[model samples]
Every structure is written in structure tokens, then in C-alpha cells.
Target: MLHTNHAKHRMPVVTAVRLAAMYEDDRMLRSIRDLAPRPEEPLSVGEVIAQTPIGTKVPVTLFPTVGINRPGTDRWPVLIQGLEEIAHWVRTQAVPRLITGTEPPEPGLPMRYEISVGHEDERQAMSAGSTTSAGERHKKALAAASARGDLAEMISMIDGSPSEPQIARWLAQLNHEEVLERMSPLRMAFDYDPEVERHNFEVLKGCRDAALRFGDSDGPHEK
Candidate 1:
């Protein structure tokens, strides 16, 4: 009787066939697998759905197949576009959902997360210009405008010798009600000169009614 090693001989062919099947399956899976989320860092499912090009550093997965359910291809543009759309939606329809007690739609839904990524080059350039030089500080004071609310007083302090016109502009930008509530009698005492006192008093009176409207609440004042 010839002792044939049938099991050993059959093993190679069987392994080859299994490998070939696996390769085919992987190829088929490639289409849908490409669509699956490929985040740079591991994120929760909700985070993965919400991420946008601006905020998150994750890539989007795209499933292009109709029904076979294969793996998707990684797509960046699609993710970006989706994020933009979601941002728009949030700005418009989602405001109510956010502010009001209305329940938001289902969680884990494929919504885009929009994030603003700052440009390092632009930031460096801005930092170069942002040094607090005397001239730069002056310019910042002017730019700060009374529009900045309570910070206007700080801007005035920084400005040192701000002109009457500049002061007026800053005061003009302030909320009328806030101006009245913050302008205390002590603030009036700062000017000992009769002429300056008269001018400041008039300005305060002019703004008093508006301040009265705010009801004298202890809140942030123009400082």
C-alpha cells in the first residue's frame, strides 16, 4: 500500500481558493468601505457626523454603491460640502431647535460639522502686526470704537489724549441706556475745571434719559 499524503497535498489548493475569495470580497468592499468615516483621530459617531473641513481634521467616508453594501471610498469634497450645507441649515432652520425647547431630530444623523480652521501663515502675519506699540495701540483704540460696549472706557484710557470728537464718537456708539446707568456723579467729579465740567455735564444729561430706560441695573458699563 502506497502511503499518500492526501491531507498535506490538498491544503495548498484549499488555502489558495480561500485567499482568492477573500481578495474578491475585499475588492467588492472597497466601494462602500471608502465611504466609511476615516477620522484622523478616533471620534464618537455623533462627532464624526458633525465634523466639517473648517473645524475638524477628520476625513469623510463615501459609499457610492447602490445596494451591494461594500466599503466606501474616502471623500473630502463631499464631506466639506455636507458640512457647509449643515451650517446653513443650522443658521436657518435649526435656530429654533437650539434656542426653543423643541426637540432636535434624531441623534447620529449624518449632519456635517462645520469648523473654522485658522491659517497659520495668516495668524503669524497678524501676530506680527498685533504688537502693542504706542502707534499700534492708538490705532487699536480708534478701531476699538465705542461699538465695543464696556471696553470703550479701557480704550479711552489707552488712548490717553483722545480728542473731544473721538470721545463723542465713542460715547455715541455706546448703548444710550448703559451710558446713563454707568455715568455716576463721581465720574462727573473727575473734572475740576468749570468749562470741562459744564461740557461733561451737558453730555451726561443728553444721555441720561436713555440710561434711565435701562432701569439702573447693575450690569456691564462702558469701561
Candidate 2:
């Protein structure tokens, strides 16, 4: 969520390096690529672990391998493998940095399978402007209930919602944004439930409101 120009530029460099590394031996790289599960495939974490090189040393935490029908989910395995290999090479070969076309990995956490899958599906729907899934609708209902101070309903909804930023943004709105901005650091450090966080809700709401207010209205100042 913290965007930096350096971090944004790092991906392509790492990607180019990875591609170059594989350029020498197409077949081997292809083999590794093949071993990776397809987005449509129902791959479990166990399957992913099995496919990784034996005794491979990974520098960062890896999410359970998932076959995602959505864009971000589809990239997860490739991104993970690319970074791990790069990290390994850096340590062993003393390479200082390797550029990649991959985003930095999310911090590792225990995730429920349902939550992960539901999240991927929800992202796809939102991006595509498709109808919201049952899970998302349920989450919205729960969030609305929470706003009304119904703790019991909030708890029930939380159980079904995916671990995603959108849900958190909605939840943040209920508590208002100014309070959230003040506590952004604490929210980043400790909160697992993004939806319940006052800060996230505020930040997201601010962005949404700004976008809506300015997106359509033409002005003399408009570029």
C-alpha cells in the first residue's frame, strides 16, 4: 500500500534479469514454468511446495500456491518463484540486486482457503464490473450492520469476507476517515481485519470521494 518510485521500478528490472537468466537455457526454464500450476488448475499449497526445487532456500514468505482465474492471483506463483530464485542467486552469486516484473510479496500470514479464493474472485468481479458475488454482498451487509453498531452481525460477516482492501475501505467509511488517518501507522502494524480498521476505511473513502467528485465534472482547470 505504501508506494515508492523505487519499488515500482524494481519489478521490470527483476523480470528482465529473470528472463535473461532463463534465456541461456530455454528448456529448463520452460520446465520450471510448466511445473507451475495454471490459473484454472486447482493447485493446493502442498502441490506448489512439491514443485519447487528440492531444498530450495526462499528468502521471503510464500503464500499457499493457488490457481487463480483472476489476474493478480494468476501471477502469484510466477512472482513468488521469480523472487525466490533471484534471492537465492543473490546470496550465492553475490549479485547485489535483480530487477523483476513482479510486485513485492505481501507479508506472510495464516490465510483460510475460503478467504483467499473468495478474495481472488471478488477482485476479478470488481475489476471487470461484474455483479458482486454472494460473498461480497454478504460482506457489504455485514459492514452496514457493523456501522449501525451491531457487533454480532459484524462478527458473522467478518467470517465470510475475503481478506481484501475493498472490504476494509468500506468498513473504514462507517467510522469516518479523519480518525483513521491519524492512526494509519498503528493500523498497518497490528490490524488484520482491514474492514474493521478506522484508518483504512477513511483513506479509501477519501480516495473514492475525490475520484467521484472530480472524475466527471469538467472545469476550466481541467487538463
The candidate that achieves the highest TM-score relative to the unseen native structure: 2
lDDT of 2 by residue, 1-223 (tens): 1123564455443221111111223223323444443243344443432234679643432233322122233233234444444444443333222333344332211111244334547644434442333344455565455443322223224323322343333344444333333234333323367565766455445544443343334232321
Candidate 1: deviation at residue 145, Å? 17
TM-score of 2: 0.18
Q: Model 1, which residues run further than 4 Å from truth? A: 1-117, 120-128, 133-194, 213-223
**TM-scores across all candidates?**
0.18, 0.18
Predicted structure 1, TM vs. truth: 0.18
Give each model's clash number: 20, 12
Positional deviation of residue 99's Cα in model 2 after best superposition, in angstroms = 19
Task: For candidate 1, write residues 1-223 as lDDT tens digits.
Answer: 1113552244332110010011222233433334444333222333323434575554433322111111132222232333345454564456648766576543312222223554558634433442223334444454444334433343343323243334445466565444444453313343268876666556444444333333235343342
